[model samples]
Each structure stands twice: as structure tokens, then as C-alpha cells.
Target: MSVLRPHGSAFSGRLGWGRAPAVVVVDLVRAYTDRDGPFGLPDPEPAVAATQLLVDAARADGHPVVWTVVRYAPGLADAGLFVHKVPALACFGEDAPGHWGELTLKPGAGEPVVVKQYASAFFGTTLASTLHGLGVDTLVVAGVSTSGCVRATATDALNYGFRPQVVRQACADRTPALHDSNLADLDAKYADVVDLPEALAHL
Candidate 1:
């Protein structure tokens, strides 16, 4: 804890917004938003509403909007070791009891939806190349389970040389502790943990 005083000391440099920025809505799906679903968050509406704000802002600004959702073949055939790690991931399987794989924030016309089998949207997916092709240098990421997919995406965004801006209000986790801690870590290292207004202003 003593060492935590100087946060981001090594990673303090900000990778500010670039010439082209895009909004990436990740895993805003039923499994997390629907209260009865297996991976549901206690209160997901706030994040959903906040995410919608970013989406609207991006559209109004004529910025690209990309989406990511977890989908697996029946029996988790494509999930690999992730299923072994978090068995709750079964909710995203094709055989899940409900329509958990459905996107809560539906993609607008022509908005590409990246179907992922794991945490990081870029892992084993074409997100990097897609962003490269679209000329997106900054990714405004919003989604659920801040400690998991959100953090993973942000970290990978940096590894792949993209500035990642994570909106606080647009991300939810199983608990406040997890959300806050992960956001702090991301802001100190991987991404900028921003608020809705600040993110909207830049859009």
C-alpha cells in the first residue's frame, strides 16, 4: 500500500486522443444486464444509460462505433480455458437458458459487431486490424464487468498501440470494490478512466 502512493509513476504518460477516435461498446449484453441471468450485475441500467450517451455522442460526431459481444458454440466448444476459469461464462453459450447473448445496446446500421469467445476483444479476433483499417487510434470503451472484459480490452488496446479511454459511468461490475479498484488500476496504467461528460465532450 505504501508503494501505491505514487500511482502510475511508470505509466503516467497519457496516450491522448488521436486524429481518429471510435466508441467501443463491449459486452453490453443480456447475461450481464438482465437481473435474472447468470452473470447479471445488481444494477446495470446506469451503465447502460451512460453507454447509450457515448454511442449517441459518437454517432453525432460521425465517429465510428464498434461493439463486442461474447458468443460461444453449444457446449462452450470455442470458449477454451476461459470456461474452466469462469464457469459462469456458460451464460454466453448458444444453449444458455435465455437469450443472454443478445446485445443490450443494439448496434446501429453498418456498425460492426465483434463476436468474441474470450475476455479481450482483440484476442483471437480481428479488432486490431479492424481498428487499423478504420483509422481508429483512440478507443472510447464502455461496458459491463469492469474487472474482466473491460480491463482486458483496455490493456490490449494499449499493447496494440491504441489510446484507451474508459468511462466510469459506462462500466459496471459485480461490486463497487471491483469496479473502483479496476478502474483505478486502468487509469494508472492501461487507460484513462474518465467520466461521461468528459468523454462526451471529446466525442
Candidate 2:
């Protein structure tokens, strides 16, 4: 196999030119990131750390920082076909303590949390309006399941007229291959895939 080059070089010189940017943490909740939770993948601690760094930078720069969690009402009626397709999600019902993660924002950090039911935070949520209200034109995205919620959120961010920046190291999937493949696809078609250090440099 050819040596895989870092994604940072791909967006060199195109980094920090947006009007106002925000960091969007999509579905980094316990149900997906915690090892003991039902739909949890492997340890997502590293991804969480990377996301924390981005969150810190965004808050320091006075940029909006939004956190998204997937919440479903009891009985799974609110989850629709998603729960049926992936029965694991049913564990994140409204009353379930496993619905959210241990990593949460500090009080009065940046912005309010956007609770969502779908993979994309922009779908059926106040995320767009929140960003718009914050005057955010660029979106720096981080979260769990690089191939699922992260990808979906990035794609929808692009569609919503926000420049989506997918933090390569701040996202994870069940496997490394899926994470790498989805990052490549997002870089090619949806958003700019960048590493944590490079992203910080841009900011």
C-alpha cells in the first residue's frame, strides 16, 4: 500500500477565509461513544479530546460552538425507521441515561445544545437557525461515527450554504477503514477534511 499522506496538505492556503465560523459537534453522545452503551463503537476518547480542542479554540475565538445529541422519545415512535434499522438506537430513549455522554460543555461556554433525532444535526433541528443567528457562515464539524452522523452533518452543512470543515482526527467510526474512506469521500465532494493541528493553525 502506498503511504497515506496527511489530509492537511490538500487544503493548504485555503484555510481561514470565511465570514464567521462555528464548531458543530454532532452526535458525540454516550449512545455512540461510550464503550458500554448499546450502539457504542470502540473507545472514542481520542475523538472526544480532539473535539474538545476544537471547542476550546472556537470559544476562544468568539465563534459559535454547538453540540448535538441524538434523543428519542420512549417507544421509539420518534426515531422512525432508524430504530427499526438499527435496534441499538432504541437504547437512547428519552428516559435513558445512556443518551448523552460524559463530555459536555462548560456552563455558558458558547451556545445552547441542539438535540436531534436524525444523523444530520441540521435535519429537523434548530441548528441552522442557531448558526444563522450567530452569523456563522462556516462550520467546523466533529463527532462520532465518521461514516454516519459526522458525514451526514457535513453534507447537510454544505447544502445549507455553510462551508463545512471536517476535522479528520476529531471523528471516529466503528473501524479505521470506514473513517478513512468517509473522510476521503467528504474531502472529494462535501467538505474540507483537515487535521486538528492544521485546523487550529487556520483558526
Which candidate leads the pack in TM-score?
1
Clashes of each: 0, 0
- Shift of residue 149 alpha carbon in model 2, Å: 0.5
lDDT agreement with native, every candidate: 0.92, 0.80
**Per-residue lDDT for 1-203 in model 1, tens only?**
34545544576577777878999999999889999888889999999999999999999989999999999999888989989999988888888778888999879999999999989999999999999999999999999789999999999999999999999999999999999999999998789888899899999
Q: Which ten residues in a row have the lowest lDDT in candidate 1?
A: 1-10
lDDT of 1: 0.92
Model 2 scores a TM of 0.86
Question: Per-residue alpha-carbon lDDT of model 2 for 1-203, expressed as tens digits?
Answer: 89978685554334334868888888777666667767577868888889889888877887778888777887767998888888777766777655354344342443678877888989998888888887888899998889999999999998988889999989989999999999988887788898899777655
Q: What RMSD does each model have against the real structure?
A: 2.8, 5.6
Lowest lDDT 10-residue stretch of candidate 2: 101-110
Candidate 1, residue 40: the lDDT equals: 82
